[model samples]
Target chain A: MNRFKSFVIKEFYHIFRDRRSLIVLFGIPIAQVLLFGFVITNDIRNAKIAVLDYSKDDISREITNKIVSSQYFSLAETLNNDKDIEGIFKKGRVKMVLVFENNFAHDLENTGKANIQIIADATDPNLANLLVSYLSAIIMNYTLDMNRLAVVPMQINMESRMFYNPELKSVYMFVPGVMAMILMLISAFMTSITITREKESGTMEILLVSPLRPSQIIIGKVVPYVLLSFSSAVMIILLGIFVFGMPVEGNFILLLAESLLFIILALSLGILISTIANSQQTAMLMSMVALMLPTILLSGFVFPIENMPFILQLLAHIMPPKYFIIIVKNIMLKGTGFSYVWKETLVLIFMTFFFIMLSIKKFKVRLE
Target chain B: MENQVVITSKNMIKKFGDFVANDHLNFEVYKGEIFGFLGANGAGKTTAMKILCGLLTPTSGEIFVGGFNVYTETEKIKRSIGYMSQKFSLYEDLTVFENIRFYSGIYGLSDADIKMKSNNLMDKLGLSAQRNSLISSLPLGWKQKLAFSIAIIHDPQIVFLDEPTGGVDPITRRQFWDLIYDAAHNGITVFVTTHYMDEAEYCDRISIMVDGRIEALDTPFNLMKTYNSENMDGVFLKLARA
Candidate 1:
């Protein structure tokens, strides 16, 4: 036990002594979360749009008032003719254009349906999709309110509601993804580099010939990183909750425990990397190219895995972070309990076991 | 000096697939003697040393280190041996005193023993003034000497030095031999490998390896006479050439 203590203390000396990576360790989570929260988002706030109403009726004016009253869209221009839409969109001043066809209110009352065109600029397709959805929801809400007062029982009004996040704040989605990515990169990258640094410096040979067992050495390498990755995970969660007004609807303790499990999984990946790489550079490259790329791209952190190609969907299933992100999203956003996240938690546990066993076997091969 | 064996190997062989690294090696290292392992580059000197240190298993041989079987009692063998690699293995980012203290602690030294031993070591190495200085700040020669001291900080039965004096100045090399002689006199067996022939002259007995086999094992005086050479370097050149 004392030998293990000394070994861990020595590992800390290496971490604290290297000032560059120390900064990176604490800096990445904060910077990435803030960037993802504020800069990269799908939230539609005061989206610029133009209105082209050919009817000039009270109902068309009322619907226009309703759309503009919502915080999501702001009236950027009033187009006098339909010919100006292509020109206005070419000017890039508005993300969408709201067009009401001729005799909109007359058509609505007589036929129980009206033709209103919602044109969106597809240059930034995600933002355009979001703009169209919000507009459609507003129109749907207005029609529902009208139907409640009408005496016609044969009208079919379609109503759709966004649950959990009624306002569709993008931070709610990004916080869990950022947590997954930061934990994987910090835990795996740090552990692999530390072990490979010892090998590169030739201290590993001395450690091997000493009284310390291989298990002790491998454990000592990972314990410090687990602590670091856990602390960073806490920082990200706090930022999401306090800074971005993101909610933690479920048990906070369960969320933290799950984060720790994922951290250990990443650390096991780090150990596996260290066994294969003989130099610090190779270890770092392998961790980034093998671990970080998959965690970011295939973990459903940014792109929706269901929307991916059939082969990538299969590939995403193999990524451990995909399950972690699901677990985090369920706990923080959906207000779910362990009963809901149990299958994901089991997958993470199995992956952790598999990585650790493989790394131990590989480490033994290296020793021999 | 010649008969109390601390390390014994009988017909040890290590092969990486079909390539023989230490082919049918045989030797013994006696207690309280400076035994030198001399070899050309890639002559498998490190492979044999690794086996003796219990870091590698011999392909098929009988070996004992510190009276413990290499295969069955590797942990016990490791506890009684100190190793210094060709690269200076001290943590460069740590202070001189911290490196000493860490090494002592890992060897399972008590806190009181650690405090006492590091003070004595720093003073003896004439590094009392640099206790708080990082190892990387010191000169190369000083670093080499400090690494050697740390390797034997736990007072193991035998210290294995794999080219411990590589790339150091001549004066420091002489002082390093003095430290080895002092350790031997204090009943610590020294098993060292070096490329310097003059360093071989300081060993009580030297084993010369050529092409994964020990070609000669004897006192430097006997090796000089057998090869009809004036010095250890000429004898090594003739043997390595053959």
Candidate 2:
């Protein structure tokens, strides 16, 4: 027990003594969270828009004020003629434009129908899609509010509704993905590098020749990484909850327990990688190419797996992050319990056990 | 030297496929003597040492280290022997005291024993002022000597040195031998491998390996006379060329 404790202390000294590793271990998580929250977001505020009211009447003007006052859209220019609609779009000043058709109040009152035109710049397709839908939702809300006061309601079958997240904030999607990514990269990177460093520097020879068993050396090296990655995982969760207003609707303890399972999964993968790699550079390269890229691209973190090609979708199914993201999203957003996440938990547990077994086998092969 | 065997091997054959690394080798090392193991590169020196250290399993052999069988009692053998490889084994990022304390602790030394031994070691090496300095900051010779000290920190019965003085001045190498002599004087067996033929003369007995076999083994003076050579280097050349 004292030998194990001494080994662990030695590992901590290696971790805290290096400035580059300290920065990577603690600094990257918070920076990634804040960057995803504020910079690369889908939520828009005060987007510039142009208006053209051919009707020039009270009802059209009232609807225009409602759109601008919602804070999601701001009026850039009010054109007199339709000629400037295409001209303003070419100038790239506004993301969207709204056109109210002629005799809007007369048509709505008599026939309960009125036409409105929405033009958007689709040069950047995702942003354009978001802009047009946000404008349509604002107009629909105004019409619904107007219907409550009037005796008649408009016959509109198509309605817009977003559940679990009414505002459809992009931060909610990124938080879970970021947690999986940060935990996987940090835990795996730390373990793989630490183990391979001994081999690279010739320390493994001395360690192997000592009375300490190989299992004791491995477990002692890994215990410190577990604590480091878990604390950083906690830091990310707290940042998501308090800073970005993310929801933790599920049982908090279950959420943490699930996170622990994922961390152990990553740690075991690192050990397996170290067993295969002979140098620290090889270990780091393998972790980046094998773990990081898949976590970011194929795991549905930044890209939706459903929209991917058939082959890539099949590839994404093998990635651990895909299931971890699902587990996190279900618990945090859907307010689910163990019954909903048991399958994912089992998958993570199985992967951890599989990697650990492979590592032991590889280590034994080295002895021969 | 006492006529007590600390290490012995009988018909040790370690083969890697068609190539043989240690072929039918046999030798014995007695207690309280500096025994030298010499060979050219790839002459099977490292392979034999690893098998004796209980790190590598032999293909077929009867080997005993500190009276423990290499196959059935590897753990006991590990506890009774210490090793220093050619490459620097101490953690460069750690301090001198920290490295010593860590190695001693892992060998199951008590805290009080570690404390006293570490201080005495630093004082004897005249490095007491640099006790807390990182190994990376120390000179290469100091690091090499420190590595040798930590290898036998637990006062094991036998200490193995695999070319422990590779890249250092001759004066420092001589000082390293002084330390080895001190250990042997304190009744510890020293099993050392080196390519420096001049250093081989200091050993009480030395073995020369060519290919995968021990071509010659004797006292340095006897081997010099048998080969009709003036020095240990000439004796090595005569056997290697044959």
Q: Superposing every Cα of model 1 onto the true structure, what RMSD results? A: 1.8
Residues B44-129, candidate 2: write the lDDT tens digits.
99999999999999999899999999989999999999899878699999999999999998999989999999999999898899
Residue-level lDDT of model 1, residues A28-112, one tens digit each, is: 8999999999999877789999999999899999999999999889999999898999999999999999999999999998998
Q: Estimate each model's TM-score.
A: 0.96, 0.97
Query: Candidate 2, clashing residue pairs?
Result: none
Per-residue lDDT of candidate 1, residues B140-175 (tens digit): 988988898898899999999999988888998999
Put down candidate 2 lDDT per residue, A55-153, tens digits, no spaces: 988899998998899898899999888899889999988988889899988998888889999998889899889888888887788878878777774
What fnat does each of the candidate structures reach? Answer: 0.85, 0.82
- TM-score of candidate 1 relative to the true fold: 0.96
RMSD (CA, Å), each prediction: 1.8, 1.7
Estimate every model's Cα lDDT from 0 to 1: 0.92, 0.92
